[model samples]
Target: MINVFQPSLGEAEAAAVAEVFASNWTGRGPRTAAFEAEFAAHLGVPAEQLLFTNSCTSGLFLAVELLELGPGDEVVLPSVSFVAAANAVAAAGARPVFCDSDERTLNPTVAHVEAALTDRTRAVLVLHYGGRPGDIAGIAALCRERGLTLVEDAACAVASAVGETACGTFGDLASWSFDSMKTLVTGDGGALYVRDPELARRARQLAYYGLETASSLDAAGHSDRWWEPRVGGFGRRIVGNDVTAAIGSVQLRRLPDFVARRRELTELYDRLLAGVAGVRTPPTLPAGHRDSYYFYWVQLDPAIRDGVAADLLAADIYTTFRYPALHRVPIYGAGELTLPGAEAAADRTLLLPLHQGLTDAQAHTVVEALAGAVAGRAGAAPAGE
Candidate 1:
């Protein structure tokens, strides 16, 4: 079966992990630090501004926590994003004000964010959906005007850019994912980029239980004061370790090739499904903007979406919806919120298999399957037949 999501890893990753195993020092040590530095360099950011975390969720939570928001504070974010963004705000004892998505981009625009703002709004969380860059400059301008903090949820946007400026660089703080299914697979790890040095330092300490720094042992590998460790304020153990960083370091080196292949496959899908009726491809990105193509989302008629997904599965081509509206989720207790664009996206959007491992022929097969499914539904009888 053609999977909707798949990770491509090979001997390079295995060799990296083997080196860590041989060293027998696989905790959060030298390898993790090296990975963080390399990743920061890749994004053209200073090493001092990056913080490595176990997952994008943790990075986002750290960003929210840095704001020191509480029950009275509200964070405006797209309701079509992964539930983690809202979960992070909720975890920080803040309210998440859901915003609608733009029909074309499937991402919340500056207008949508502006509409969601209330007197209690303290921050704006923008997600680059499917690795497609949103209108960050406009949103940043609005944030500046309102004196609001901008937190970028760039989990699917590693290496994505707008005119050479990376997506994570536009906000006060941003979180990037290198999970098993993302463009850069790190088993399960992420990084947080903070524009402020103090925030970056605090994030590092908070990730590791607020442990106080101390000097390294002597050259002889012996510590005269082994029991003199210092403790600081309360914190959580949400930092990445050397084991995962080992894998991530190798994956980072292959990110350019991975992104290229995914784009090639996506272009093939675009050409193959250009004329199919009842199916709409993702928005065409403007010039100077680049999408990482983490997922190739297509919008179908909401009434026939389920039928097409079932037909694709039966044909051995897996497909699934991208995201459900966050406000409708039971855990958030935001059912009363009305976000038409997000609700429309939740019902019509489906993710096609677009990864480095997918070949041109495989992409054609996926498009064929989708086209056939939609065509079959178009000619089907009415309900109760």
Candidate 2:
């Protein structure tokens, strides 16, 4: 079956893991530190500012906590966002203000964020939707003018950038996912970036039981009391281990090739699906916008959306929607909020299978199958009809 998401792994990854296993130490050791330095270089940041976490979700939670968000503080984010972003705000006793996204791009614009702003709002968390660096520069400027903190959920945007500036670096703090299905897979691990130097120091300490020092390696050569940790505050062990980093380093090295292939596939899909009836492709990126091509979504007539998905599945192709509108979620206490743009996009958008594992032949096959499915929809009207 053609999967909606897949990671490209091989003998190199296996060798990395084997090396980790051969070493006696595996928990947040030398390999983890080296990977952090490598990733920091990838994002063009100081190595000291980067910290590895167990997942991007943990990074979100850590970002929220670092900002000290609590009751009465609001975090404005797109309603069409990953559950982790909303949960991080909600779990911290802060309100997650859901905003509308552009119907075609499925990304909230600066105007969408402005409309959601209140005196109670403290921060703005924006996702680079489908790994497109959507309005992040504008939003960062907005946040600065308003004196609001910005946290970028760059989970889908590890390689995305505007020119040479990375997406995650646009905000005060950001999180990246390196999970099994992400562009750069590490089995299960993530990286966090804090812009402020002092805050970055605290971020690393806080990620690992709030210890004053980094790890045993620092004390190993300095003193006899190597095991005694100087507790800075109550924290948790959320640091990424060398076992995962070993694999991540290899994946990171191959990222450029992976992104190039995805870009090729994206253009191919665009050419093939351009004239397919009842289908609407995602909008093209503006100038200087480099998308990671994390998600290749197509919007269809809402009435026939489900039927088309069923047809695709029957043909042994797998597809799914991401990020149902968070405003409509009753748990967030904003179920009555009217976000026409987000609601519209949610009903019609469908993610097509686009990953490093997908070959050119498979991409053509996907479009062919999609075209056939849409054609088979007897009563399906063209998208706007």
Candidate 3:
């Protein structure tokens, strides 16, 4: 069966892990630090600005804590975002204000974010939906004007950028994912970046038990009493391990080829599904917008979306929608708000299989199945009607 997300791994990753195993020191160590530095370079940021974490979820939670958000604060984020982003804010005693997104793009516009802002709003967190850097520049400008914090959930945008500047660097703080399914597969890991050097230093400490201690390898490097650790702040041990980092380093080297193949597949899908009945392909990106091509999605008639998806499933072509609208999620307490844009996305959007492993034949098979599904159901009434 075709998968919507799959990691491209092989001998290189296995060999890297083998090396890590042979080294005898596999916790957060030289390999982890090297991976962070390389990733920072990829994002065009200082090495000190990045902190490796266990997962993107951990980075999100760390972002909330580092921002010092609390009960009276409200973090404005796109409704079509990962649950962890909302959970992070809500868990931190801060209110999460869910905003709308463009129906076609599934990313919040600056207007949508501004509409959700209240006097209580302290920060704005937005995901680069499907790896499109949606209005982030304008939102950054808006955040600057309002003196509010901006945190970018760049989990989908490992290689996305407006121009030379990276997507994750636009905001005050940002986080990225490197899980098995993500563009950069590390099995399970993430990283955080803080614009301020001071805050970045503090955040690094906070991730590792908030301790100002001499590391195990270089115990005597810092001071005489290397055994004694100073507990600095309230924090958690959520650092990425050297094993995953080893795999990440190898993956990072091979990322360009992965991205190129995905782009090739994306273009093929666009052409293949161009005229399929009831199908609406993703809109062309604006000038200077470089997509990471993490997810390739299409919109269909909401009434028949589920039916078409079921048909595709039966045909062995996996299809699904990401990010059910967060506002409708009862836990956020914004279920009553009418957000047609986000609602439209939740109802009509379907993500097709667009992973690095997908071949030209696989893509053709998916499009063929999709076309057949839509055509078969086109003449019929909506599923239940």
Q: TM-score of every model?
A: 0.95, 0.96, 0.97
Residue-level error in angstroms, candidate 3, position 223: 5.5
Candidate 1 lDDT, 136-200, residue by residue in tens:
88898899899999999999999899987899988899999988888788888899999989888
Residue-level lDDT of model 2, residues 15-35, one tens digit each, is 999999999778888899999
Model 3 misplaced regions, further than 4 Å: 214-225, 382-385
Q: Higher lDDT: candidate 1 or 2? A: 2
TM-score of 3: 0.97
lDDT of 3: 0.91
**Predictions ranked by TM-score, top down?**
3, 2, 1
lDDT of 2: 0.93
Clashing pairs in 1: none
Query: Given candidate 2, what's the lDDT at residue 324?
Result: 91
Whole-model lDDT, model 1? 0.87
The lDDT for every candidate, in the order shown, is 0.87, 0.93, 0.91
What TM-score should be assigned to candidate 2? 0.96
Q: Model 2 clash pairs?
A: none
Question: Whose lDDT is greatest here?
Answer: 2
Better lDDT candidate (1, 3): 3
| Candidate 3: worst-modelled 10 consecutive residues by lDDT | 213-222
